[model samples]
Target: MASFEINGGKRLQGELVPQGAKNEALQVLCAVLMTPEKVTISNLPDIIDVNKLINLLQAMGVKIEKVERGTFIFQAKDIDLDYLQTEDFKNRASSLRGSIMIVGPLLARYGKGFMPKPGGDKIGRRRLDTHFEGFAKLGAKFNFDQQAYFYSVTAEKLKGTYIHLDEASVTGTANVLMAAVLAEGKTTIYNAACEPYLQQLCKMLNKMGAKISGISSNMLTIEGVSELGGCFHRVLPDMIEIGSFIGLAAMTQSEITIKDVSYENLGIIPQTFQRLGIDMELRGDDLFIPSQESYQVDTFIDGSILTIADAPWPGFTPDLLSIVLVTATQAMGSVLIHQKMFESRLFFVDKLIDMGAQIILCDPHRATVIGLDRKHSLKGIQMTSPDIRAGVSLLIAALSAEGKSVIHNIEQIDRGYQDIDLRLNNLGADIRRM
Candidate 1:
């Protein structure tokens, strides 16, 4: 029920440290179920989703000990699979999409798993067909009844085979990877999702004695081993947060520095933002965005209006499409924003339009934004958050608006960004969490 009150039109000038990646942390936490030995994770983001996952793991009898604020030591020594059948587990598990990932690890380790429908950003039909399909290929049997998904694999020794995913679904690939790590034979996954999150998952699994190649590529070859041992790994910095900060700095004309960013991992982020005429200087592992009067939206090489779209990894992330769309509203030129991954994501543009942004929501998947070029600033208004990315988009818009803006459903934002209000406040943004 909390809201953010932002006094906008102020230049944010300071250094901001990015937190650990939320998406990566979710997978890493689920990976703990792969082993009964203690696994220590450092640099974990203290976000709501991570906390929820940790609580869920603990409820399942995983020994979760906080080593520090952003570090934790976990051991799923005595997993209670029966917990998945309770209403508490169902309610919490259904609140986040990452909960679906537990199915594979639980089945691999415990030989059985059950979970109710998982929940996440209601942008599109996030199907579990890919996940179920991948598991079936790995000698797993599944049943769906009474609004719950039940999966079991009777094969004492799981033998791996080639798996061509129906789609390059991120969680689907991850589930298959988790299951294949301990199978009897080798597993080859083609058309896999090689996003940074998945890459980190592969790295962590390899560290634990699972043989995996093609870390950042679509085709992954996993040589299933007898068992995985415990290992310590640090979660990667939140790239989505880094992208969000970039958009925030651009929209507010802020001079900000993002610290401890892995520059090499940022594949197409810089180039994607460059299309909006926003440039940043790379200082070692940090990114410095200086305050600017206005940004220009570049046109296509043929002098046509530019279009920014999202794709799988090596392409622009769909998660950041909302950020790019919101940032474009403050730029000088016009551009088309295409969100191919989700249908309802662009529907939130109506909120931006109400804030004086010249946006045409062409459909559920596309929007055309004409930048105000600092000649006009968005006036503050009360709005509701639709999802995690869209909620952060509203926060950026609120931060750049001329007056106070109230954004409800702060839980949506909390699910992703960690201490967002506090972090932005450090950069001199006049925002209060109410």
Candidate 2:
């Protein structure tokens, strides 16, 4: 369990480039299994989860070649089904939640797919019922062995059908999209997740000869094709990382230029930060945040209190709520941060309160943060990272504090961000891994 020892109050400067989208990379990489031709994907982030998935793909006999540092050429011409059935395969597959995406491609190409229970951040109860239900609606039979903690799906021939997901589950939509691309006839996914990640998936599939309409809407129409071809795909910049950098700049009172941000793809992120009274300038494809002495939280037009909440695509993403919450601790007023998606995500505010921030954790989903208004800097303290987003939020808080702070379980942070400490250090942050 490595930790991050940080000397707070170091204002990061200069230009920084955000890494490729981690969530998008997970979905797009799984799509490689849908086609046998050489699929070239660029802007791949060097993170633990993505790397582990690449290794799992290689173990399953997918031929992989490095095109460059952030690019890869994958050809899944031959897959070792026997190898996939081994205990070693099950153990590795169960280690990451993104690995569950393999089921869609595997079931589409082969007749069956199986895996043990998937693992990821224990922030809340993330159920796979959406994935299973979507698969079953697409004419696939679903099975789960409670004793073995395994799930399997099978279909002799998948027939397109109408699927209205119970919730707009991101990975669920991607999994079904992967399966539906190669099915027969038309498949309609109502209430689909139209995030940039899913949109990129749909676009990449279309480039590979899959027919998908409604690129950025709640309803998606897919015309099933017998096969798909390989195509080149460059993932969009990680919106979550971009949002984090915006929060980092405001929290630490720093000036930063985030290069090549793909501003068009970041729908509501920039505006969300603006709501926090943070000023940012858009310079071509980059985002420039000037150093700020103080920022205030805006109340509603009726002079009511302010609320920052998360929603689906075209709405503020839930992933950045933790960053928003932690950053609000230093603002000039109060704000209610509502994390509707995950229940336990807000529990980490207790650690922030211990560090001298005024935070009221209202149940499992909401937290009220009273800003310190830059009057008194936070006192550093030892803390445990709860999950990926919370871990990064804590890192941001630590960087903005007065003294030294130590954060344990930094592996959680590594799972999402690529070389975070090294990259932040280059920008003048004091973060040491020990």
Q: Pick the candidate with the highest lDDT.
A: 2
lDDT of 2: 0.93
Q: Looking at candidate 2, what is the lDDT of residue 434?
A: 98
lDDT of each: 0.89, 0.93
Candidate 2 lowest-lDDT run of ten: 79-88
Error of 2 at 27 (Å): 0.2
Model 1 / residue 181 / CA error / Å: 0.7
Summed over model 2, clashes come to: 0
The regions of model 1 sitting more than 4 angstroms off are: 146-156
User: Tens digit of lDDT per residue, candidate 1, span 349-395?
Assistant: 88999999999988888899999898888999999999999999999
What are the TM-scores, per candidate, against the unseen true structure? 0.98, 0.99
